[model samples]
Target: MSLPEPRDPSGPYRISVVCLGNICRSPMAEKVLTGELDRAGLSGAVEVASSGTGGWHIGSGMDSRAAALLRAHGYPTDHAARRFDPAHLAEHDLILAMDHANLDDLRRLARERADIGDRLRLFRTFAPDAGPSPEVPDPYYGGEHGFTTVLDMVHAAAKGLTAELAARYGSAL
Candidate 1:
């Protein structure tokens, strides 16, 4: 099978996982994917990060409970929130969004339709067994369990995503 290099060879091999807000879903996705890659011994080969659809939380660390949840799950929790940039449309090799609205936002930023063609996909599309969960729910306004739920979804999706990456970019892994 052919695996896509999650990262670009000419650069740091970056994968910018994105959601509506950096604090919750996207960061959770980042941690899960990064952790899965780490388990596969591709930690250094995969450069993972998270950003938001809006600028409200830029330069902020993930929520405290979110950090705790990540640690509880034994995944790295370090992240700084930032809004999605138009340049990101060109920067990231793959852009995984939590929902269709965010996908539309990313698509709207594309300078050309081909710029986003087949690149931006729903995160749940890669989930191992999360049935019909199109987007990981935002846990920011809810209680701690919401964060855990988000983590659960993120972890499953990250696993499938990593395996896909390995197949797509066999030489890199």
Candidate 2:
């Protein structure tokens, strides 16, 4: 199925990127998407936030490797870890899960909401080169290269997502 239409074209199109631990993938995705949105000149019209399916790192800062990778690539590195709340379904236009497991977690959490299926999606769905793998791998325990790899994946998806949003709400931007 296709993505749902933007709910509030005139207002901010909110998005939430979710991963297993907020300290890693999701925060990186959030910064990349936000930076891409800002570069596309939709900074004020689109807002991107991030959280985790688990609450282990809630209130913690992003992993040093992630923050370094983002800053090295000219993206924002300011973010704190948070748990993905079910209430985010109401506040965000889209909720992108980094992996299928977390996507499943979000789907189960969103079971009570009628439009859950419409807003929830895999983050890598937007990446043209994402290929058969749809999940953004967790780099928490990996070496430095892993963080850079995640950054590359997030960057591609962020650009694609920005284009999609720009097409839908270019006038507002």
Candidate 3:
């Protein structure tokens, strides 16, 4: 799908990645996407952040497994968990949910602002080979292998999204 135009044309495009809790999938996708944007030379033209639909992990760091996997892959591991604020609908150019549940939460919060509908999408939708199911499965309750799997999925989606951003904004960069 085509990206929505920046809400504020002169400012960097803002993106918020969200999941059930800020400690896992969303933060992983956030850091991975940030790195991909940097690699694509669009880092300065875009801003990335992450939050959760639920408050369970609010104020905590990213899940240990997720942090370790990102560190091993050379991605930064600094993150402070926070809940997704409905006000973000006005602030972000795009809001990506890690799974359908989080998407539903975001959708409910956004019901009052119908104009922002185009900004919402599943994080995996950007992955070229994501197939029919685009949800990024939560790795919180699983073993190390689950984190590894999530990282791979995030990396693929990040690369695809970066390419699209570069195509649209590369000239300015």
Best by lDDT: 3
Model 1 stretches with alpha carbons more than 4 Å out = 1-12, 111-113, 171-173
How many backbone clashes are present in model 3? 0
**TM-score comparison, 2 vs 3, better candidate:** 3
Specify the poorest-scoring 10-residue window by lDDT in model 3.
164-173
**Stretches of candidate 2 above 4 Å error?**
none
Reference-based lDDT, residue 135, model 2:
85
User: Which lDDT value does model 1 have at 64?
Assistant: 90
Model 2 lDDT, full chain set: 0.87
Task: Estimate TM-scores for all models.
Answer: 0.88, 0.94, 0.97
TM-score, cand. 1 vs. native: 0.88
Q: Rate the local accuracy (lDDT) of all candidates.
A: 0.78, 0.87, 0.92
Summarize candidate 3's per-residue lDDT along 108-158 as a digit string, tens digits.
Answer: 999889789689999999999999999999988999999999998999999
